[model samples]
Target: MAALIVAAGRGLRAGGDLPKQYRALAGRPVLAQALTPFLADAAIDHVMVVIGPGDNARYAHAVADLPTGKLLSPAQGGATRQDSVRLGLQALAATGFDGIVLVHDAARPFVTAALMRRTVDALQSEIAAIPALPVTDTIKRLGSDGRVAETPPRDTLVSVQTPQGFHFKALLAAHEAAVAAGLSGFTDDAALMEWAGHPVKTFPGDPANVKLTHPQDFDRSQGAPLHVRVATGYDVHAFGDGDHVWLGGTRIAHDRGVVAHSDGDVALHALTDALLGALTEGDIGTHFPPSDPQWKDAASAQFLAFAAERVRQRGGRIDFLDLTIVCEAPKIGPHREAIRAAIAAAAAIRIDQVAIKATTSERMGFTGRGEGLAALATATIRLPEPE
Candidate 1:
């Protein structure tokens, strides 16, 4: 089955510089957290995300490391949530998807695989299935006047959550009918399905699946404590006969290059070692042996990616990476920003979290003699405390 994640809303209520879905949560974007489970689920065939116009850059940064084979290009969203969902359904129809579809909210990042399975399983015997949590608080109805009109039984009221499942064709047809009928205010996919005369069945919802709508919702002090670690790395390479040198994943025109089995990106290599050191996972050479013929001329970016993945596998995140290149021949100031961006992309972290600097050896060493280059790196990372 396919999954559509709605993330186009402005999310003003969250009160942040970016949309709530793009906001950081537990060191990762909320949308990224929400998309991981569906992407990892073997049952899901394809996943589509709908975003606001001009949000392509933000979306790209958010989903950089995710698997993309089953991820479709984002669909442009409309004015209202209802309209955005309709446009998503239309995009699916264009792709000729007629199987079950799960519509999810990007703000609710805590959704679990079990809940997703339950929703899809419920759809096996029902036309539409929505996950809902029975209300435990007293329910009241208010009148136009500032007075309570009536109090309803709390046991009869339920709060709805998402990844609402439905037959793609039926939901698409219902959305089209609503548009033709000039209807525009339905809040969720299940409501539209109900309006179209489809029976909406309720399945149990997880209480942990709370939607983030305010700044306070991002406070992690109420949750688990994170352990921080710092590690440093240093690498040196002698100048070879090549006309260009690779540093921090950026190739620079130089009078000479470094002698190494790989691309010899000194900056990235040091940073990778720093990350591996932080995890106590040994050095880059331990993972990618210099003797391996298959890794000959391999991009240093792959090594950095591998180290970053190890951090993620341990439920850790790179907080900051600082790298300094020491050389005298090729000027680094000209390519500093590009190098920073390249490293950030390779490490799958934000650009601001990465710092790149360059300095000369004062013409006192191998770098000053124009014979080689050296780089130093320090990485700070946070990981969940071992139980």
Candidate 2:
């Protein structure tokens, strides 16, 4: 079966510089997190992501490390979520895909492998199957005057989630019919299928698979109490013969470059170590040893990304990162924003959450003598209390 991740929506309600799907959650883009399980699953043959117009570059960066063979080139999506889903289906149809398709939202990064399996398993007997959790709280119907008009039976109500499983051809046809009939605001794919006279069955949904809709939803404290950790890192590189240096994943012209096994990005290296320290994981060298030939002249961004992923694997979120670069050459003021953006992208956090500053060593130390550069970084992260 193929999986289509709907990531086209702007998600203004989530309130970030980037769309919610592209926004970072636990040191990785929400879209990346949503795609990981599907890409890793042996049962899923192909995976496609539907994205908003002009988001190709951002999408590419988000999935940079993923296996390219399983991914289809991103399809541009329309103004609405429904439109995006229909367009994705058409794209899949054009590729001669006619098997089962699972539709999911990129904002629900917590969707698990087990939930996906349950949805797929249900399709064995039904044309459409979705996961839903029984409504536990009493629901009330409101009147025009704002008073509760009726109390609905909670036992019959359920909160639905995706990846919703469906026979590809049937779902594609249902979407086409809706467009032809001018149906505009049906929220989910299952609702459209129901409108097309197909029976939709519900399997158990995971409560942990929460959709990120509002700004507060991104706040770990808003959902559950968490434990916060802070760690600091410092790194320095001596001047070498090269004409330029790599700093925070960006190349800057300088009289001399740093001598190191990797790209020698002092800022990124420090940030990576800080993240590892916060996670109680060993330093960067512990994971990517300098003795390994594969890491020779490697970009420091990869080191930072590795550390960030470790934090996510432990179910933690990076709350803030601050780095100060000490250098005598190649002033950092002009590139401060670029460095912040680069670090944020690498660490999978918001740009606002990262801070970059520059300083001099008062002409006393190696940095002041124009011999090399140094960087100090502090990382703050939050994780769920240990069970």
lDDT (10s digit) by residue, model 2, range 134-213: 99899999999999999998998999998999999999999999999999788999999999999999999988789999
Per-residue C-alpha lDDT of model 1 across residues 49-126, encoded as one tens digit per residue: 999999999999999866665899899999999999999989988898889999999999877767888999999999
Q: What's the C-alpha lDDT at position 50 in model 1? A: 97
lDDT of 2: 0.88
Model 2, runs deviating above 4 Å: 221-387
- Candidate 2, TM-score vs. the true structure? 0.61
- TM-scores of the models, in the order given: 0.61, 0.61
lDDT of each: 0.88, 0.88
Q: Each prediction's Cα RMSD?
A: 9.6, 10.4
lDDT of 1 at 277: 97
